[model samples]
Target: MVNSKIQAAEENLIHVYNRFPIALEYGDGMYLYDTEGKEYLDFAAGFAVCGLGYNNKELNEALKAQIDKICHISNLYYHVNCGEAAKELNRISGMDRVFFTNSGSEANEGALKAARRYAYTKKTGRFEFIAMEHSFHGRSFGAVSVTGHEAYREPFEPVLPGVRFAEFNNLDSVKALVNEKTCAIILEPLQGEGGIHPAKQEFMEGIRKICDENGILMICDEVQCGMGRTGSMFAWQDFGVKPDILTMAKAIGNGIPVGAFAMTQEVADFSLKPGDHGATYGGNPLSCAAVKKVIEIFEREDIVGHVKKTAPYLEKRLEEVAGEFEFVTGRRGKGFMQGLVFSRPVSEINLKTIEEGLLVIQAQGNVIRFLPPLIAEEKHIDEMIEKLRRALRKLQ
Candidate 1:
């Protein structure tokens, strides 16, 4: 039965999201069942946030246990779980320090502030940041300022000044935009919302070189591409390029709200003095406990290895389906974060796929994004592909 509450929602609530006309009740594994008891294969994975899949036992248990112990504690006092989570994050990321936030945008905000502060310390008048075109940072003022999408930033005109845009996957464009006045250059190793465009190897190396030569801090926003989503623990590691600072969120806590920014000791030293930045709910005990368990599960299950082994199979299946559809232009991206570009708009296809009992997301440039949970089995992949095939046939 469709809930009357949902219908009421459409009438009363703000229509921020033109959401699919279905109310999700619960989910298990890679499947979400709607209020009407209809099952749908979940390939979007809650916009790439639910890494362990729906209603994961371990993650649920961790949350339940934490709920009994403690839920929220301000950063005014030392918290055990938050401290431990920071240590673990530093260990995993090979960074000296970690500052936690509640979302990816907040983490990026911290990174931007830190970059500006670092520049201030060096007596460098550089305050500008060079971001890639089509990049999708969060909706916060600082994040949207650096984001490349005009649609998202159009309404909120008069954003922060000194943000310059460069072309994604184009190193020369980045080189041309970055100068001594540039304090930082931020990019996603794999562009997510903009489209699943992986940074070319040469481009990755080139950005690092530019940062090195210009003394600019290289900030990699791994909010969507990190946390074992891209076969590797960090996507930057895959290209053998390191950043002075890195921001992460999404799957970090396995759906628990937690985000972090890490930086080298030197970079963290400048601009981020005591009381420089803080979050009210950041680094809370409950979120940190979830993050700890998430990391443990990743290590014990070898989730990264699983993604590497299975991604090619998933990609092959997607490619095969693409070949059958005349609308499919090409496929791009890395590991589990793949995109199928189509000659036509994908919004109709996305809606139709939902009706066919599958859930996926449409990216910019008319691409259908596939970000299944890293723990998903081959059976789930096959199910998703089958649904996609059915949707394609209907579209044709």
Candidate 2:
């Protein structure tokens, strides 16, 4: 049955990804079951999208209730949930206004636009952006233009101009690029796709300070690192720095499709007018309901505290596995988002771990990223490390 499904995907669907050889049927808690009922310990969590884990009862109920009432009512009309979702996000993120989008890409796009438009009123001819190397924003033209990786951008040459690259975690490099034409400096607080590297406190503070001194908007791509992954509503909170604009997605709606870019009242005022930007199904009723429920669940359960508690155990377990496996080069990241860097390519270990019923994310080709649900317990960490041990033993 799984084989047939894979064949059908190959025959009918576009060949964009070289997916793992299992058809996930359903997921519950920290585990996913395949079509054949083989259980896989889920550390990937759909690349940090499934923060509450799979089959969340409250979230399911919320979506179901909203489905019965109304699933979508585009931006032309009001959905109480839509406004409520934005209110909740603003209340937590400290941003003055919110613009709902469809994905992290769209949110980043909005952030970029907000930066440029705000700069338009503040400074003359400030259209350039300085982004960090090794950063992965998204695949959209604007998002990809700011993304620093060569491979992701090389495909779509002649990307949105006025974008320059700087080394991540280096303040001097960013300052070197800042000139009269610079509008914003964008970076991930903890880079998810670029090997799970977290910025140091000084670096983050420097970025914030630079943005302030230069009148440049500091835009954080919190799509992967936000939603309590780093033991806060937003990862920038850990650094004691607030962004001029922040973009969040992935876990914000649990598993639903919703994203948002928020900014200060000043930026929001100058950014986009009625004719400038819009999304048709951006903040529909159903997705906003999911967002509300997810935020409520996080607050009620103290999900950030849960991640903070379990993260040390997860890190310790990964360290032990590294001590046992010589190929394990290092570990990095904060809270629930971490990566085990390998001496060689991670492709073998990734597949081997999947074969042994553990699902982890492969990042930057040589790192195995663990982005477990925020609800993951110590037992889940133990299971993940034990399965990783099995996979590493195969290599030895």
Candidate 3:
């Protein structure tokens, strides 16, 4: 089965993902079982998407129940689950409205469109947005255009115009770029693809202040950092700042492909009209069921409290690894969304760790990112740390 699956993917699938030499078939809790029945510890959480872990009993039952009831219903009509999901998200985020999409990229695209429309409503020709350097939004044309990595943007040139790049955590730099044409500024609370760099408290406060003083819209793309992956329900919650608009995906559905962009009451009131923007597959019943269930589980299980309690143990273990390894240079991020920086690229370390029966992920700046499920306790943390240590020892 493993060989057949690998061969099938190699023959038919697009060669975009840098897939490891493993053919995984199933997962339970924080462990994944390959086609060969080899169990491996999971720390990647499917790139921070599987927050509830795999085959969660409640989630499975919910999905089964939803399947028996209904799955896909077009956006032209309303579904009960979709409305409930939107209401729950709004309650959690303090946002007034929700627009769902198939993936994080589409959610961010929606937010950008709303921003442009909001600006046009306020004043004509307000199209520009300020994005930060080393930030990753998504891969769609508009999203990639605002993304800071030149490599991702160079080949896909002529991306949306009027977008400018600014140094992250530098309020002065952001202030310098603001003008009448500027409509919004989008950033991640903790940059996931940019090596898990969490925003400093002062920086987040400054961004909020700058946006308020300038009458500019604020966007926080929490695709990789939301859904209680951090200690708070959302990364922005940790800093006591709120955004005019917010985009979320990944763990929102705990592996189900669901995404959403939200806006404040005033922004929703003035932004895109009925005919301006829409998604055909957005907010379908099946996906909405998953989203609603994930949110409910988080609240009922106190997943945020678990993350807040167990993250320090993971952090201390990572710090100890850094102290022991000469090549280890720095650590960044907070709560469960953490990364360890090395003086050299961590591709080998990542591969070696996978071979050592652990799954991890990589980010920019030689970062080995650790995003375990919110259910991870001290035992999982200790096991992950020991496996990581074994991998690092191989480098020596």
Give each model's clash number.
0, 0, 0
True-structure RMSD for candidate 3: 1.2
Candidate 3: deviation at residue 358, Å?
A: 0.5
Q: How would you encode candidate 2's per-residue C-alpha lDDT over 260-312 as one tens digit per residue?
A: 99998988887878867899989999999999999999999999888888889
Q: Flag regions of model 2 displaced more than 4 Å.
A: none
lDDT scores in order: 0.91, 0.91, 0.91
**Tens-place lDDT digits, model 1, residues 111-154:** 99999999998899999999999998899999999999999988
TM-scores for every predicted model: 0.98, 0.98, 0.98
Instruction: Write the candidate numbers in order of decreasing TM-score.
Output: 2, 3, 1
lDDT of 1 at 43: 90
Clashes of 1: 0
Mind giving the per-residue lDDT tens digits that candidate 3 earns over 120-159?
8987577899999999999999999989999999998888
